[model samples]
Target: MIGYVTIGVSDMARAKAFYSDLLADLDARVLMDLDRIAFFGQSMGKPMLAVCTPYDKQPNHPGNGNMVAINPGSKELVDKLYHKAIELGATCDGEPGQRIPDRFYGAYIRDLDGNKVAFFHFG
Candidate 1:
């Protein structure tokens, strides 16, 4: 069980703007905001997504094999989220489409901080 997921960013303002607009698709609002961190979630207890500067005060870099997957609840929503990310300047890692016939439909992108993120739906 995961409680939350956090990714480090070098520019807080840019990261905030990108996530604020992107996560709005899921109706997730800012649940918490501190000097160097911000959390977004649709409800309490649900997994919250956070973006922050590293506490060690060193430059931040994207992890090579780590990613955050977001489930927006439907194939249509997945497509919408994928498009929204691209519109907001995210680079595409995969286009919106079925990944395994009728089992999984998803899309992937690298966010402003270069962290991989996925929008998916299962049927």
Candidate 2:
């Protein structure tokens, strides 16, 4: 149902490098890199994450209460990506753990641009 989520960033270079390295294990790459925007994903047609400068030419800021959640396919990958995000300079928003007994396991972090991203597994 969702195609892509766009997050505004103040620094394109840092944001691009941060995501490129962080999502590499998921096989996501720089699918598109334009002047003011870039898209990353495993491929076209699948869901993607985009980073861009605010279109109005004003400063960019992350929207409160907005977040992007990614399912890494397993609980183990959730932990792996969570750690990777931290190593890449993301601040931990939530630790890796089973949020719902026998059902959900997840971790959360704020990317370099302060965008909330969640890695999770749902069974």
lDDT of 2 by residue, 1-123 (tens): 788999999999999999999899999998999979999999889999999999999998878999999998999999999999999999999999999999999999999988999999997
C-alpha lDDT of residue 117 in model 2: 97
Model 1, stretches more than 4 Å misplaced? none
Q: After superposition, how far is residue 107 of candidate 1 from its true place, in Å?
A: 0.4
- Worst ten-residue run, lDDT, model 1? 35-44
lDDT of 1 by residue, 1-123 (tens): 888999999888888889989989788978888979999888768899999999999998899999999999999999998999999999999999999988999899999878999999998
Cα TM-score of candidate 1: 0.96
- lDDT agreement with native, every candidate: 0.92, 0.94
For candidate 2, which ten residues in a row score worst on lDDT?
59-68
Best by TM-score: 2
